[model samples]
Target: MNGVITPADTLGTRLTGLRGFYRAGYRSVLAYRADLLFGVIGFVIQTVLAVAVWRVLYDGHDEVAGVASSTAVAYAVLAGCIQSVVMPWQFSSLPQRVFRGQIGVDMMRPRSLISQNLAQAAGTMVGRLPIGVAGLAVGLALGGVQAPRSLLDLFASAVSILLGIANIMTINLLVSMIAFWTLETGGVMILYRFASAFLSGALIPLWFMPEWLQPIIGRLPFQAQIYAPLSIWFGTRHGGELIGTLALQLGWVLALFVLLQLVWRRAVHRVVVLGG
Candidate 1:
């Protein structure tokens, strides 16, 4: 009988699975070129609307809402370009698979379940990144806009985006695992999306939010996802503030990853969809 697997065998299996998943995810949006084209067109329309809004607010003065006109444009433009195309899809399929037992087979695979899914998500994001980069270029050209002034600002913005994605993945993976314990993940995903939409500065900038809510909502991990990154891109943050933001992001990443490992252990102990 086949008693067990070796380290080399396990590593090979995981790599093969990762490659397969990556290719499958890569081919996803290609199946719908029309949708991809429409997505780009939609970003263009959004760019127009944002410029119109900026004009109304910045009529006589170059600044409004406590931020410069150019910075505002960068925020709006990036939000429109990135969120419209690369924003996370809060899919509730993980929960459905758990309850319906579709994930049973997936669990039996040698690779970690969440790791496999993360690989798929990472590949999908990469697949979409080129299109998003193109849209960003088109947006900047269409509006002829410039971002923050300093090299520091550009660096801050890029760091924010990278860390923000890491944080998002950490949070989403944790949420996905929730399905293992609770089947009612629709409400969970809905709540998560609502929080992201309202708090993350995806649609509205944080400065526009009510002052009182800032202290409370600001601490939430969702804000770090969109606002902090966009702020750096706009050069709104500097010095000590930048360090604090990055620290917070690192803290959450570490915390969530730890929680995820614990959750996986408990989940598998309770129910191994694959034979142990």
Candidate 2:
């Protein structure tokens, strides 16, 4: 009886292991102070530019397509800062680890690779939170960001944003799994970035898209990443519409997580390292 591991013990052990990985990831961000400094600076610049661009676009126009200029600028700034933290352009080192035969070490660990990866990714996101906050501050100072419509909307936006981050992480892990077969994901990652940036509304909200293209993008899972949360933040989709958006975002997160697990299983079996 003393030796038997209870369910609670197992859960606790897994959580502990995930916490260690998360810390490692967070520390990795701090390992390079210069890089972090420059990265934050660049993010601020990007956020300022986005704010400027939106302001210029909305110049002399109070409202365009049912969205006020202030709302549009606010959305652009918030969306840009969010994207800077969440949808980083680089594919994770998972692909490289697989290519270099280092994935075996990760696979041999007691914890599942997916959990470790997700924990690390979450830690990295948290570590970079300051950058987003700084950029958001700049936007707010410049009158480019607007407060949430209300406390309820703010709460809903928070939940939606969490779900959106989960959605993006799962999708990223799924794409990284491609390295199991191809061993190189540069071109694929570039395509993924462009598709995600545009389809996810990181560049421009779906409201600005052509009517013909709106339906197609809306049907895809990308909209759940950035658009849903920001839409809630800006109160563009309220009442039943907000509820529906959150439902769809939650559905995508759950669906993508399942799909990621399935892909990871297949990818594990396909892993073959020669002469390493």
Q: Which candidate's lDDT is highest?
A: 2
- Across 10-46, the per-residue lDDT of candidate 2 in tens digits comes to 9998999899888876787888878888888999999
- What is candidate 2's CA lDDT for residue 223? 92
Model 1 off-target regions past 4 Å?
A: 1-17, 90-93, 181-184, 269-276
lDDT per residue for candidate 1 within 1-276, as digits (tens), equals 287888989788778879876776667756777876776676666677786787667778877667777667767778766565446464324565677787878787877787777776666666666556765787677663676678888887788888878777777777777777776777777788667767878778888888898877778888888888887776667899988988887787778788888988888876765333
Error of 2 at 58 (Å): 1.3
Residue 175, model 2: Cα distance from true site in angstroms = 0.8
TM-score of each: 0.83, 0.94
Model 2, CA-based lDDT: 0.86
lDDT at position 128, candidate 1: 68
Worst 10 residues of 2 by lDDT: 267-276
Model 1 vs. true fold: TM: 0.83
Say which candidate scores most in TM-score. Answer: 2
